[model samples]
Target: MESGERTLITLFEEIVNRFPHRVAITAGDQELRYRELDRRANAVARRLRESGTTDEAPVALFLPRGAELAVGLLGVLKAGAAYVPLDPDHPGDRITWTLKDTGASHVVTVPGYADLFAGSGVLPVLVGMDAEAEAPSLRGGPPGAEDLAYVIHTSGSTGLPKGVEIEHRHVVRLFDVTHPWFGFDEHDVWALFHSIAFDFSVWEFWGALLFGGRLVIMPKPVARSPRALHELLRVQGVTVLNQTASAFARLAAADDGAERPLTALRVVVFGGERLDVGRLRGWIARHGDAHPRLVNMYGITEATVHASHRPITAADLDAPGVSPIGFPLPDLVFHVLDEDGRPVAEGVAGELYLSGAGVARGYLGRTELTKERFVELADPTGGACRAYRTGDRVLALPDGDHVYLGRTDDQVKIRGYRVEPGEVEAVLLRAPEVSAAVVLAHSYGEDDVRLIAHVVSDEDPSVLAPRLGQLAAGLLPEHMRPSAYLVRTGLPLTPNGKVDKARMPAPTAETISAPVAEPDGTSAELTDTERRIALIWQAVLEVPRVGRDTDFFDLGGTSLSLLRMFQQVNSEFGTGLDITVLIEAASVAELAQRVEAARAVSPSAP
Candidate 1:
């Protein structure tokens, strides 16, 4: 790409021209080669152009994981528009707000979601239907390097999600800088495991498409199940893979019990959450580090997905408790500074500030916040430059690497998603029954961190628990939902009149919402299958008891929790459960039926 002409459209066109017959994406049994994907995307681009969407317009993609999603993303970019992906699993209210917030004039979805935006003002471009029709040519040239490519909405402390406006130049430079470390080629096959709503997907998609590699789009169920995902990696011959530490830990455990190791993999990248170094030592003992090298990265959305990369070696296993994230990319620069804006010493801990080629344009339509977080600083060259305040604390190593500590703000990471306690608290307070709410992250076991919401309300804790759970289900994403709710008439306050979080008690096992009896005030009866599943749910969901009819989601069971439950279920029943099994089973009774059917169909040895 030329200096000022680098753009997704330009780069993608080059790939299409280079490898038109190479398979670009694989979703289920359907495979789309480069030429076909380009044609499909062009069809979408034509529809958007006909819909009057101009360059740099924010286009909402409200589709699930499938071929249509891929078309919508590529098509939006082809139309010179920025795509904003919306998780279909999220509540309708949140999706509505995101569309309104972005002022999106167009929404790309399938026929299944036609009713979702019947009277909504935006023009709905149904992918399956619209892309098949004949349309007029696009109106203008492709979007430039400086134009917005995507707006990723992350958790905001102000009770809503904030859109981080990333430009094409930022993303283009990302691969340019990191391509040396990862010599990705046409022979490589990658997995689109994470949701497109998350910034991680940016790397997943571009990393494969840019280098003419095949990208396998994992189904929702397959992505959640460690065993299922490992099987897919082996069967699909996946070479390049990226995962969060929490998710990879489960995959590693699954690999341990597998009959054969996945030998096709060339590189395994870890990011999103902190790494457990001890876990890697165990993996290295089995797989060794030479073939499929381990690389740990630390990054944020504002920095266009990744900032620093640390290649893991046997020596890194003995680096004490610190997670050393190696050095920043060539195009990016990092500064560890104190609150006074002065640079801290090499070994001192301070806030991490990043600046360089990948620094985002700023928060969408939020000038005040853009000014506050994205501050101007003096470059080493003695000129002014923009830098993003990461809000994470880290200390520079003697070798110029940075070791991650923890967050310095109210923000926390749940699974791989960056969650804001204030956002969850605000959602809780939306209910008239909740007067005051506080959400905090609590660690139960190793790598089992969850959010617990403590509320001050007049209603009884038992009665309020279900109501709060239902309310949260309709207002926030699964990761943002509180696992447990603790109610109090009034919270202990400090002399300063602020709620003293130190005095508040964590939810004890007894206080957790556990079903003791049936709704009819009788003792619950469970079959053998139900009992086994109930026990698994009890451990994974952190509830003392799971009734026959207890809804898995009502208890704040997220996808990660469901994954943990599936591992135990597969171990006990030897069913190797697929996600479709859970399609009819959101409760213990329903799941037991599915489990029984699965066990009878293809039971394997435990």
Candidate 2:
């Protein structure tokens, strides 16, 4: 085989041959050298084959991040079967979904996690990697480059997760593309910070297994704290580090610097979330010259792991704004397309679409969805060619770099106007003392769409309100500016670590500090009825801001919340308005008017 044209299995073989004595993985106090990992994987694979499993069979691995997870995955590959990684910490429903989705008949897990799928009808025959399992005879098996290696399920924020089936060729292509960035060698010790279930872990494993680099898996507790993580890196003599943006942000936010000396570190990579430019600069400054090379990688689960990475420099730190995600890595092709599927002009915002070797073979078991998103492109060659329609909105810069905008679905139509939540968030984050910002839309029955901004800051919203209005005027259209601004101490986060915008509080009039009246009286003012209704809205939505024009749903008030509001209004006013009336006139002002009308027409009253 040519030097660069090696599949994942072949790559692992090379590592066992050339660097057998080098340490490959570390879990707790246990260590597995490259030779040990290879030998054990071969033994496990031989056992699996003896059990009647073949190269195409699905083997499920429900282990946490550790040596066993690594060996188990490679063993499945060696047995000519695809491995499905299931995070033990994930909810049981999610795990069950994966099991049924993949039809996995065998599972490799420790004794403690064996019963997690007790009732699962397909009940994977549990295989133990402990000392008790027989160490079977090792045998070599050849798998073609196009054979499936693994299936990675995406974080199901929108719906049930779909598995992206990645082949060995995709893995080989990625290693070839990113090898030079980290300068992987037998001597390098790469810390595994991501969950084995995450696609990034696939990169970490392959980077080490192929290049002969040592993989050091940190304990679960240490992975949670920056100080503990820092100490582990230094103590373990880790040379390469990789973490998601949120993890890096916590590390950068910590006061302790020397806790993890960066002297031995050669490279630091961040992915899985949007990187905050200011936070990145702060991290670079704290580590100083001893800091390793910083890389911002961009990818989706549909793309094996990472499709592109750009090395950060001091000049990049000094420049304005967050850095562009940079160009695609070698063998990958990035295209920016307009709504009509035509190529977008330079510097124009468009939907980002990915093509080339990094793209996966489509969602496993979801033919309709797979065909919808992954379409055959116009490739001159007669062979198979595909492109993924990433719904991400981005602007293609003149330098061939791309600037990320918010998701296309997040765009809202407010007051007969179009609005992008990211534009609002950008303005809020740029505000003084604001550390983070999230914008969520609330909707009521009417055409009203209200924008609520959740900002993390100690600054008083009263003082921040007018200034924000001023800042927003220049940057946003009237409709896009949030009707209500809320200063939250912090935002919520989902399990996968991305910001939980869906859980953000609705914006109400209460959160905003009343602006001082201008002498010219140009500011919008509320009438007594408006004020009373706003108060009612604040009580109902549990938000501080409630403009008369704001939609009840737009205030984060759901139908359930509206129902409660109706009960409260009925109790306070002694009005006998039916629940149907409240549901019909969903807007606060409209519902208030209905209350007044009902009072005026009540029979046998007065």
Candidate 3:
């Protein structure tokens, strides 16, 4: 293939030919060299092709984080098909919805995750990685650059996940244009620290493989535990890391009093959420910005992971509380436009419209949404060009940089996931008793944000609230699930008869506490340990009070918030506790029990 005409498949094949002996991926104790990875993925491609999974076919990968995940992603592309990654960790309903929407004819999964497709309708042809590839070589050569590479699903404002159609060239040019800024090479080791369903993982995996680097697939347990993840980075010699700002905050705090610091990381790029520069003060004091340079990138999935980038240093800590996304890539341009689509003056806040090589091919099977979000405008050359309208409100700087303000709509980002409050509200409104529902996002800390749902119902709060909570848990993922569900007799409305979101009451102890009562209408008071734990939860969650039995997730606690809460609990109690403990023990009473159990075995136990 000509160098200028290379797609992801061709580019990756070139890398494989050049570095066949180099280790390409590491997951757990298993490692796959470029030669082995190529042979394996090629076999998968052959099998897919033999099974009639041809060009532009949407093959869904419903697998866990493993070498198989990479194999599936590459294999689909090698078969001239676009891969659709489905997070196994998400709610089953959501997974089913994605499968049906994408109309995937094949699924790349393992035996352990085979059950994920149980409720996904009649099921696609289940192609396991373990299946020996006895088929012939793929007939067609690699797909063209304009061919669809992947279809990533993003939460939609209309209560569904919209599949974004990204072409091979769009993603290839992302790194190609930014190569000068970051000289990634084979020597670097990167961590696949995000869910494959998330776009950040696209940057993580491709960034490593395209440059002949080693990519480590972080196990779910290790990914959730800050202590374990830090140790993994140190032991695995990870050099390039990608994280959401909130996740990095917990990681920095975990590194605070460590006997050994992570010195291998050379580039820590923060994306997925608006970075809070203030969170990096202590890390700067410890590591400085020389070795592992910090970068804050502003982007959305539609813009192919990142559009703008700025270095974050101690110098930024001195500036105002602003998130500065330095500038767009050389090939990408931004239009800070008013509601009427007119260009706004520099330094004036407006919705960010990104256009250029980074813009994807628009939403799959969503012509109306695609037209609404991705609009056409006159380019400098006088021809029409397409741009993706990011709902983010940004102030365009004279230097072509952008300072992120906030979102223009009700959508809010929680732990790097773009969540549409209306999606959650739509789920809540499914309950028969719910007359009206609104989901709101609130920040309990600088980086810790959570979702709160307010529902209008005539039913008793105690009986109806828990049902809504259970319903959301069954239908929504942990990040999208509301941390708290408040019951209201009636909703506040505006002059236009719309729910006056501005008038929605800020979450407080009494307002949030109205949702629950004992099944017998009698509750136990907080014990000393439970009270201490409650106090810590109250402080970390920024709530007035946390009862002994209050469910952590029901209180609007997210994985990031749980991490922050545990960091404090572990410090105060001098116990090594994993954040995953919340999975089984979420309430203050349950966590206190585990805390006491850990203390019993500790030398500090009295």
Candidate 4:
């Protein structure tokens, strides 16, 4: 491709022509060669074009993660339209909101997911249903560099999701700057572990396809299980892996005592949330800095995907507080500024602002918000450009690296998903039983945070907690769901009468309402395996006692806790089990049953 031709499709096409026979994508047992992928994507593009998708128009991709998703994304771009990724696992309300916000006329999905957009007035074009179809037109070119590449919706404070419009050039610039740093090539295998709805997927998806690398599409189940993901990395010889710090923590913990879990990995890029350097000590000790480079990147969806990169070292882990975000991508301008927008002195904490080629166009349909957050500033060359005001508070080190302090706003990232606490609180207050609600990000483990909802309700705590959980499950996505519901007669207030979040009680095993069977009632006795599991839970959760009927989550167990428990179970029982097994089983008795079943089949079982 020519230097000036930097659109995603053009760059992708160059790679496709260069490596036609190369394996482009691997999902489960299926593999698609570059040539076949191009042909399939072209066919999808033609179908999208025929369905009235025009230049820069949003086309919703509601398909599950697989070869079809990869093809469908490329096809949308090829059809001269920006793709809006809708997570198939997202709540229907969220999907509906995203579809309506993007005004997408066409949706690309697989079978069984057609119902996701049934009444949304979107024309569903199912891929993989007929794979042998030919393209109606292959000569049509992709959209211009300035045209929209993708519109990613992020949590909004206004109780609705806001779409961040990123242009093709912005995406191209991101790769152009980071390509040398990552050293991606056709020999490398990248894992698409994140949901397509997230901006991180942009890096994982195009980073592989544009560089002629093999893209391994992680199934939802495999993505959730750290053990399974570790096995997949080794099995598939994955070289480049990107994960949110929360997710990486689980993976790193799962690798404890295992023979070098990620032997094939060359670079592990962390984003989405702040990297807890201390939590990754186990990983760094297992594999030193020379083999697999561990990088902590801080970014926002508004700035394409990533803005800055920091190569973490074992020594740097001891640096106090959160890991430094390091330096900005080449040509990107970052400033730590005070409330007055003036640059703060070195070592002073201030809001982070970024301006560069990677800066996104603006929010879709929200012009005022776009102007408020994305402001025009003069460049060093006396040229005017836009810069995004990242709500993150960072302290600039003398060495040029910035230490991520925390968010200046209420926005918190839970498992890499940008969540507005108010958005979740709004949903909570809608419930008839909830008189008032306050949602906050509570840290369960190191750098691991979950949404905790404190609700004031007239109903009993036991009755209201489960009802609220059910309400959240229906209205919000899994990440947004409250890990623990603390029902209070009234919200704790400070002297000023404002809800004092600091004064709020931390969720504990006793405070969190669980399905605890009556002690005098018909509670099943714990089996040996169940007894061991209960002991593990009791220690992990710090609860006085864990009964067979007690739910792990209700006992303040976060995803991180589950990973820890899973690691313990694997070590104790010598049985290979995925973390999803815990999530699926949920309760103590159910998980014990699964453990017993696995142990029963194991030849090593006593």
CA lDDT of each prediction against the hidden true structure? 0.84, 0.69, 0.82, 0.81
Which lDDT tens digits does candidate 1 get at residues 459-549? Answer: 8777777778778878888788877777878888999999888886667667765233333333468999999888888877767677687
State every prediction's TM-score relative to the real structure: 0.90, 0.67, 0.90, 0.89
lDDT digits (tens) for residues 217-312 of candidate 3: 999867765667888999999999999987787677567645678888999999998876877888898899877999888888998999887988
TM-score of 1: 0.90
Q: Candidate 3, 420: how far from true, in Å?
A: 1.0
| Candidate 4 weakest ten by summed lDDT | 514-523
Model 4, global lDDT:
0.81
Per-residue C-alpha lDDT of model 4 across residues 9-116, encoded as one tens digit per residue:
888888989999999999998899998898888888888877777788899998877789988888889889999998877777778888889898999988788776
Clashes of each: 0, 16, 2, 0
For model 1, the superposed segments whose C-alpha errors exceed 4 Å read 128-137, 513-528, 536-541, 545-606
Q: TM-score for model 2?
A: 0.67
Candidate 4 deviates by what RMSD? 4.4
